[model samples]
Every structure is written in structure tokens, then in C-alpha cells.
Target chain A: MVDGSARISQDPEPRKNNRVHPVLKLLYKKRWAYYFIAPATILFCIFTVIPVIRSFILAFQEFRLMGNVWVGLENFKYVLTDPVFHRAMRNTAFYTVVMVPQGVLKALILASILRNLPEAVQTFFRGAYYLPGVASAVVISMVWKWIYDPNFGLFNFILGTFGFGPYPWLTSPKTSLTSIMLMGILTAPGYYIILYLAAMKKIPRELYEVADIDGATPFAKWWNVTLPLLKPTTLYITITSIIGSFQIFTSAYVMTQGGPGYSTMTVVYLIYNTAFRDFEFGLASAQAIVLAAIIVFISVYNFRVFSTDVQY
Target chain B: MRRACWVLVLVLLIGSLAVSFGSIGAASKWTGTIQVWDFPRPAAAEEWELQAFKEFEELHPGVKIEYTKLTWAGGNEKLDVSVAAGQPPDICGSGLRLPYILQGALEPIDDFLTAEDLKDFHEETLNAVKLNGKYWAWPWYNTLYVMYLNADLFNERGVPLPENGEWTWDEFLSAMQKLTFDRDGDGKIDVYGFGFTFQPTYLQPFGFIYAEGGRVLDIDKNEFILDSPEAVVGIQRLCDMVWKHKCALPGAGGLTTTDVNNAFLNTRSIAAFVDTTGIISSFEAHNEKVEKGEIEGEKINLVTAQYPRGKNGQPIAAGPGVGSWAVFKQKDDAKREVVMELAKFITRGEGQKEVVPLIGVFPSCKSAGNVWAGNKNLEHIVPAVEYAVYPPMHPNWNKIDEKIMRELQLAVLNEKTIDAALKEAKRQIERLLEY
Candidate 1:
């Protein structure tokens, strides 16, 4: 492999004469590296990248089995003007605004507590918290649906015991979207916790020692030393978490069905119904592009506010 | 020696070519895979569900049916995606919704459904299968959306059964009031007399909406007419049961069929609810469990009743009124014929007689003729099919349904007045219909 590649790369006459493309020459020089990742890259292109490109194209075409008709901006115009789509956008924005912070905070609290525990205890607790992420979201939603049931649910039963009124957790328009948001905050913050844990372990132990010598309390030490150092990781988790929040579907689809009104309908659920339920694939694709653009805008805003650079 | 070898090779080659041409000369029967996606019917009908697949395979060697099990909750999306992917099953038991028709994905069965076979089908059943006067599916069974009353609850409350399973709006309201009580004298009401789901995608509320002289749409003119006063009063009457009369369960406006049914079965707190004949199988199963002592309770004495009369003066039933089978478009005519044959083998002749009764639904074919002739549970609703109605055959039915139900839900929850909700729904639907 080295003999063949070295011969090609070392021969600079073709490159100097502009016979070989610069990108191709560079790829040829790194042929072994390319070969190692080629399979995965090909698969990713086929499954993810191509479909995304096609979805963008589909946004401007009326989809049909036999053939698709070009509809220009009609699909985008319809989705923007539709009241239901507006509701979905508002609901998605709410999820992003509310759940993302709660999620980051919960993970921070969890990782901070667990890192101080004995290794054995830490391992056990981490595994326990991570168990839910391994389970199907659809299955989790079904369990939550029962917990939120108005008359016979666990929440109502608990309230009844306290001589409080039964709340329509998922059934009322006022509370339905909040119930869905509450689920996001309440579920085990396994993924984020793991990320925070790994980031926390890399902080120099001497930073804490210096803080202790300065007579700083544990809270002050954490606030001054741990959190600022974890900013890069926090920024990463926050961006990803916001993306996840915007795409909330399985739970809403299973629990309230975006109902009582269009209260709980999120952008992804609307896209799904438009494409699959109503067969308006072009409109669904347009809605999806709008959702992607919103996520991109928010992600950029998050970076401007949270991203940090540290030599360490 | 070389000449002899060449002659021998030529003789063998000619023999092979002659045999190949001989086989190609005869008309060959087509055989391959016939794909099917179906929801779980009653476990009682499991045998019937697989029976046609088995018989079709046996009758035509090399023909195999690949079956995929689908859940009722998720099946619509699955079917839609499959159709959009141009990979729908050759045989599926989805209703003749207009979306598939407009996609030109379904193969109309008119050519295969003969005139003799046509005579046996109910006109309503035929109409349900037809759009633009072309029949698109083979009707297997028709289900009526009627009220199911727990007779035990009725008796314990000393409320008489609807006389002849018929009640006017006043009588219905009075019975609901009498039956609802705080059983343990707790501050909270223990059981509701009547409960109805107002979710979109379900036609449970439609029976009442159309109970009076209200029709959802005039299909001939293609208009959204629910804002008409007749429909408003009909919807208002239901809203009153939840808000004014307080005879229905809490969360009735947004609850699911499963929610209300579970409340009735497990809590024993719901006396009456509305559903299609498909639910009869579920009730029968629950009864079986009760008899076996696996469940704790008296066997729910399920009695079928019609929705109370509105100003229309006759009981009304409405829903996705009929369940039928359609063959999706196929690449080969011979395979299409085979798929149509399988559809016929499942719905008509002996097929309807065997499958329809096991599932406890009324047959679409008149010749299948009262399979539940003496069953007390079906005594009233079996005849109520005559009054059954369905949604207008709109291509945008799902969206239209969503809007209408959202408005109705707001009305039922007292978030909006019935008139306002209907007017808003009509205003939105007119624009959608224009599209």
C-alpha cells in the first residue's frame, strides 16, 4: 500500500502540470484513511444525506406514486398560513425553550452528586439511571399515559389522597402541552448525565485543592471551578438537547394525540400527519425544512450565548 | 472423430431449444407472493383470518401470502407510508378512504364483482365502496355505531332500558340524570350514567350530531354544512350532557375509546357509551374473562341501543360505517386477478358466513342473512345498520375530521360555544374543501 501510494503522491509532475485535481491528489495521498471510513461514509450518504437532499427537493413538488408535479413555493405557502402548522411551531418552540434548560440542570445536578460517590455505588446508580434510555420511547409514553389519566391515574390518586382535585394532566387544552413538557423534564437524564460525568472527570483535581486552601465552601468550589470548566460540554449537550426537544413525537402521538385542542401538537408530529396520515407529502416536506431552519437558528443562538474556548 | 463430436453436440442443443420453445407455447398461470397487512381481528376470527390465505395458497401452488400484523393505532400511518413508497400490500383490509383512491393506488373491483354478487350487497355497503360510481373494494362487513349500555348498571340504578332500544333526547337525558349518583355518598360522583368520546378520527359523536336533522356534508354539492342550526343543536345536546347535565364522565371531550371502554370494564363506573360493532368482540372477550373468574365483577350485561332521537325523530348511527377490502394496484394483471380472488374468497360466498359472525359484525351481503339472528346482544343494533351514516366521502377527510373534532372538543369542554365552534369549523373546512 505504501509503495503504490508513495509512488503516486511523490510524483508531483502531474500535480504541478495541473493534470490531477488537488482534492483527488490529497485523497490519493491519504488513500488508506479513506478506505477505512469508506463503507460507513457511503452508507451515511445513502441513508441520511441523500434522503435529506431528496426531502428538500420534495418540498417544492406535489408527491405522487406515479410522478411528482413541480409546485414551486405553494407547499411552503400553505404550511406557513395553516393555523395548525402555526400551533405546531409555537408548541415546538415552547418545548425547546422550557425543556432544554431543565434537562441541562437535571443532568448537572445528577453528575455532580454521583461523581462524589464511591466508584462501586456510582457505577450502580449510573446503570440504573441509564436503563430508561435503553427502553423504547413508545413503551415509555404508554406508561406515562396511564400515569396522566384523569380519573384512574396515579397522579390523580395521589392528589385524591391529599384531598386535592384531580387534574386533567393530558386531557385539558391548558395542561396538555405542559404535561408533555413535564414528561421531558421528569424522565431520567441519562444521556446528558453521562456526558457531564465524562467532562467532570477531566477537570484537574488541583483546582479544587486551591479553592479549598482559599477557604471556599463546596458550593463555591463547584460554581467557580467545575461549572465554568464544563462550559464546552454544557454547550454541546444543550445544542443536542434542544434538537431532541424540537423533534418530540412518539410521546405526543401516543399520549394526548395532540388533542383537547391542537395544544400538544409539535412540528415533527404535524409533519408526520401531513405526510403519512393526509398524504400531503410535499407540504410535510416543506414543514420539515422549516423545522430544520428553526432548529438551526436556535442552535446558532445557543452557541453565541454559551460556547466557550479554554486552553485546557 | 471431430465431425462425429460436432454432430453429437448439435443434436443435444436442438433438443434443449425444442423443449424450451414447447413450454413457452402454452399459456402459463401466474404465481408468486401476495402481500397482506391486516389488524388483529378478534382472536375468535384468527382462524378465519388465516383461512383464506391458506386456501389460496393451496388452490394455486407456488402462490404464497406474506402477512404482516398491524395494530389499529399505528396501522393508518403504516398503510399511508407504504402507499407513498409505492409498496402497499396486494391485499389489505383498510376502508375505502378517498386518499388511496386519489393516489390511484387501489384497483377497483367492479370487473371482478359480478352483477349476481352485486345484488346481495346492501346499497349503503355498495355506496361505501364506491366513489365516482366505481366500486373500489369488496365489502366484508358493515358496523353500526350504536350505544352500548351496561344492563347491570341500568338495573342497579332502576332505570328502565330504552324501550325497544329507542329513546328521545329528553328520555335519554332523564335516564342519565337518574343513573348518575355518588354511590358511597362521597362528595365526588362515583359513576357516570353516560360517556362519549369526542375525539376526531372517531365517528362516535357523529351519530348524535346527525341524530337530529343535521347532515355533516352534502356530498353532491361538496359543502361543509355543520354550521347549520340543526347540527349546532345536536352537538349542543351532547355538550350539555358533559357540562350542563353532568351525566357523562370527566374528560369526555378528549378521552379515547379505549379510555372510556376501560372505565366501563374495570371501574364499573360507566353505564353507557357509543362504539361500532367491532367492539362487540372486545365486550365478548371481557365477558369470557369474567366468567372464567380471571376478572373481578359480574359479566357486564352488554345491550346495544341506538343513539337517542333528536328532532329527526328516528335513532341514528354513524361512523366509518363499513369495513371493506381493497387490492392495491399491481404490476401484473394475472397477479391482480389472483389478489381479487383472495379478496372474494375472504368476503363473499362461504367467507362472509364464516368470518362475519365469528367477529360479531353484521354482514355486507344480504345472502349472509342475519347470521346473528337470535343473539340478544345484537338484537337492536343489527337492525340499526339501516340508519347508519358515514362521513362525507372527502379526500381530505382526516384533516376535515381533525378540524371538526377540535371545534367540537372545545365546545364540549366549554372553551367555546357550540355555535362558535361549528362556525369556525365550517369556515376552516370550506377553505380546505376549496383546496
Candidate 2:
């Protein structure tokens, strides 16, 4: 069998001694493919990979004015016992629980509705929904801050019309976290909706037609065809949303400043305060690593649940 | 593929060329370009810089001043990064916080000033700029916290003002109770007697600890004395004002400078503990409303007094005033000479006379105070300045203040008992001192 395979390979390239080998020729023919791929890979390495590796190295060391000293596990130990770190972890967990499912489900529902609309109407709605994603986070946070102002906000004005008392949306410890989470939910979900809509549109019409011929009802067809086809997009969105939720910082930092007594202090905000405010770069790096590990674990779990060899 | 590589190369070449051009452009002689980093004041950076530069340019023609404005919130970090990067501005204005000086981030100006130049500034004001036996910064403006009362509220309640800018704790509480009222006749109270803030400096009246002759930190021993009897009494008095007397608002622990100022401006509260600078602006902004029949009681009369005297019978107020100036060491010799000259010019009697009114910042020089001696608007600041006690001058003051203030907030908000909070603060401060 080896002799026969070798003879077959030799027969296909009889004049190879005078020129480049066929394999080399094939690779050279596809040189543009490699060229096209190089830019994104280089960018990804520089921007994402390098920083990530640097952050990992920084986690085990003590950063001081003079130089960094390697004190393995010391920073991690400090992070575990630090009250501020604990508070940050608790706040981030609470925020994730409140924000992630709500964002994902709302996007899914909106995408489903949009999918049934006329093509032009769907396009307009998609663009309108995705507009907030294009806005600067600082501007969005500021606008939301004004809207949630207790003294003369639009929210308070609306409540006043209904004979309800004004709520301290961003001030009171009781309502501040929820109010910010609501902003997060509203500002996000739009991009995910657009993604899901595109994914749904890509589902072959023949699948639904076949289901219909098999006497599948609208709901049945959607359950058997549309939902299954959208699983990969849903998985992607879920992992991203989880990671995004874990790193929620700008809104809380700008609006409430983790105040009314640490009610809105997310893990990333704490990391920022530790590194920049207190200049405890080592502790901040450790906290960041812990955060990253949690994200990786959740992503892996999501992949296991969503992607499998047993395809429907 | 070849075209793409060429494009990438061209882009990189252009980037490098642009960078080189920028470096060459910046390499030019000073040519009147005075780089300045100013923190947020009511006056815009450009407006203030232009005014100062225009005057300087007239004196020394063919020079331009470049000004960069930094926000107060992150100004220190930005300044630190610039210094670390070895590209700090020729001049920087910062709060008279000690860490910057201790860290050698600022230049010492002792060599620049002669004995005669030094003699013009108040000794205490001079002390504020000194760190480790060297003058690290020049004192530009000073402000002290003072109690401002709404005269209309005091008159209506028949509560007499302090006899001589001094009142005991009991008398202060009695006045606060009488002033606090439910205007709508509802069971719930709409107005608070005192708009007390839970800031570190606001706790100054409890200066009984220092008056009782207790130190904030034993610099020699490097330990905190915050849990001392004097500190306990001061802290207890603050808590009593909130929980027992009910004179202070419940959310006073979280009150911001803007919130307290708003309360005073909107007539939502009777009294406010604020800085002299804020009072100046408040009066200026509402002077017309006071003249008209707009504010309640047909003419709002605002009066200032010293913080209520502690039980020791000696009135003590926390006077932590921050000054701005140009440091000589931070700049090259030529830049240093110019900065020193500019500093002298600005802090001179003439500069003070020109800038103080526009900025509303009190002058650091005694001569400048004389300029505003008879002005009614600036009259309130005079008494506060006279008796203002400076906060402890330590390199770690920022850390100390943050820990102390956090504890004070907890104690005031009843989140922690006074003893526990004070102990925790002392422990934290001790840790800070070691660093």
C-alpha cells in the first residue's frame, strides 16, 4: 500500500526536478490567503495576546516604584482576605445575576419579533436598535445619569405625573445598583439582537418548508428548526455577554461612583481603584487574574453545554 | 498582497515621520512657551492662562504660554504619570497635599526665594509649602472652613446667634433643635437644623483632642493617636449631632460639596458648614435674590461664624488650606528662572490685586489680604483665616485623611460604633504611617 501510494504521488509530479515541488506551488498559489490573514493575526497578538500575557506575569509580582519583585502567591492571598476585594466580588456576582439572563432573553425575543417583520422594516429597526452600541460609553453613562437624577429627572417627572414619589435612582444604596443594571440592560441587548436576527435570517427556508410539509405548526417549526439553527449564535452571545457583565465599570464609576456605600462597586471598578487610586498594582493584577479565570471557566462551561458532536 | 505590504510600510513610515516632526517641533527653544498644568477652578484654564500670559508677554514680548487643563479628580495621577515619564510641565498647580512633595515629584523653591521674598508670606502659610526642611511649593491661595447661617431662619426661630462666635456643645444643640422644623405641619420634618457633612475637615470642631493636647499622629514614634480620648469625644459629639440631636440630616454621611451648597442656595437648610470660597460664590450668585423679595422672608441674610467652640472653651477650627505655585527644581535652569519670576509676579501684591477678585481665591500674601480688607464679600474669610488651624503636615496625609474620613462616615451613619470605628481608623492610620 505504501509503495502504491508513493508511485501515485511520483506519477502526479514527473517534471518536479526542474521546477518547484507541487506542494510548494500550491502554497505559493495561496500566498494571498496567508497575506489576508496576517493583518488580523498581528493585530490580535499585539493588542490582546501581549497584554493578557503581561497581566498574567504581573499577577504574581509586587510592583513598586523601583522595580517589580516576584512574590509568588502573596498577591492572591491578599486578594482572598481583602474586604474591598470581597465586596467587589459580591457586587460583580450580583450584577451578573441581574444583568446577563435579562439581556440575553430580551435580545432573543426582540430578534424573534424582528425576524417576522418586512425586510426593510427589519433593517430600519436593526439599525435603530444598534445605534446605542455606536455611541461613546461616557456619553451614554452621562445621559443616563441625568435621566436618573432624583431632583428633576425625566423618570421622576413621569413618576410625579402618576402621583408617585420621586425615587433616588442613582443615590440611594437600595436602588443604585438596580438602576445601573437597568441602564446596562437597555444599552446592551441591541447588538446581540442584531446578531441573533442575522443568524435567524441565515436559517435555510427549505428546513421550515420541510417541517411545514411534515405537518409542523408555526410554533413546532420554530422549536424544531429556528431555535436549533440559532444555537451557535446564542452560545457566542451568551459567553460574550457573561464576560461583558463581569467587567461592568464605566457606568457605575461615572454615575454612582460605587457609592451610597459600596453598593455599585464591581470587580473591575475595584481593580481600577486598587491600581490607579491606591497604586496597589500587584493586588489589582491578582484580582484581574481571578476575574479572568472566572470568565474562562464560565465560557468553557457554556461551550460544553452548547456545542457537542451530537448535532440535531 | 505586495500592495498591502507596501501600504503597511507606507503607513508605518508616515507614522514615524509624523512622530519625528513632532519631536523636532517640540525641540525648539522655549520662545515664550510656558507649559502649565492647572486643575479645575471655576475660571477656565485657557481664560486664566491667557490673562496671565498676555500680561507676561507684554512685559517680555515674543513668548507664548501653553496651558493644559486637568480635572481635579485625576490631576494627581496625571501629574505622577507625567513626572514618571520625564515630561512634566514647566509648572503645575496642585493642592498643598504632602505626598507629592515627599515623593520628590515637586521641586524645592528655597534657593529661588531670598530672605526678603520669604518674609512677605505668613509664616504658617510658608510652613504649608515646606516639606522636609525645604520649600517644595509656593503658596498661592488659602481657604478655611467656616459655619454660615441663614439669618432668616435664625430670626424666625428666635434662636440667638452665638454671642461671640463661640458656643458650647449644649447651646449649639439647643439652637439646632429650635431651628429644625416641619414647615408643612406634617409629623415628618422637611428641614434640618444643620447641614452637617461627614468630611474629615468638618470634624474639626472636635479639635478638643488637639486642644486636650492630643496629637493626630506621633510622627516621632510613627503611630496614630486617633483612638485617644480627645478623638473619641470629638467623634462622639459628631455622632450625637446626627443620631441623638436629630439636627443633622440622616444622609449627611453621603452629602457632597455640591449637595450642601445646593441646600444653602435653595433655602432647603438653615445652616451649612462650608469653605470660605463656596460662601463667596454663593453670596455673589444670590446677592440679587437677597436684594429682591424673591427668597423667603424678603431678603436673605447670610452670616459667617467660627465653628462652635469645643468643651475646652477654646474654639478650634480645622483650617486645611491648599495653595498653588510653581516649583523651581521640576524645571530646567532657564525654565526654573522664568517660573520663579512668574511665581513672584503672581504672588506679588500686584498679581494678587489682579487675580483674587476674578478667581475668588484668597491670597496667600499678607499684602493681598490687605487688598480685600474692607470688601464685604471677602470679610467672612478674614476671621476663619485668623484662627484656622492647619491639618497635620505629613507625607502620608492623603492616606490618613481617607481612612479617617471613611471611619467618620461609618460612625456618623451608625454603620459602626464610635469606639470600633475610631479603633479601626487608628489601626489603618498606623499602617499608613509605616508605609
In model 1, which regions exceed 4 Å deviation?
Answer: A1-30, A117-128, A308-312, B1-95, B105-121, B293-298, B311-313, B325-355, B365-368
Worst-scoring 10-residue span by lDDT in model 2 chain B: B200-209
Q: List the residue pairs that clash in candidate 2.
A: B32-B63, B32-B64
Instruction: Return the lDDT, model 1, position A133.
Output: 97
lDDT of 1: 0.83
* Alpha carbon lDDT at B190, candidate 2: 58
lDDT of each: 0.83, 0.70
Tens digit of per-residue lDDT, candidate 2, span A71-156: 99999998897765787788888889878888888998888888989999999998899888898888998888778766446897
| Model 2: fnat (fraction of native contacts) | 0.02
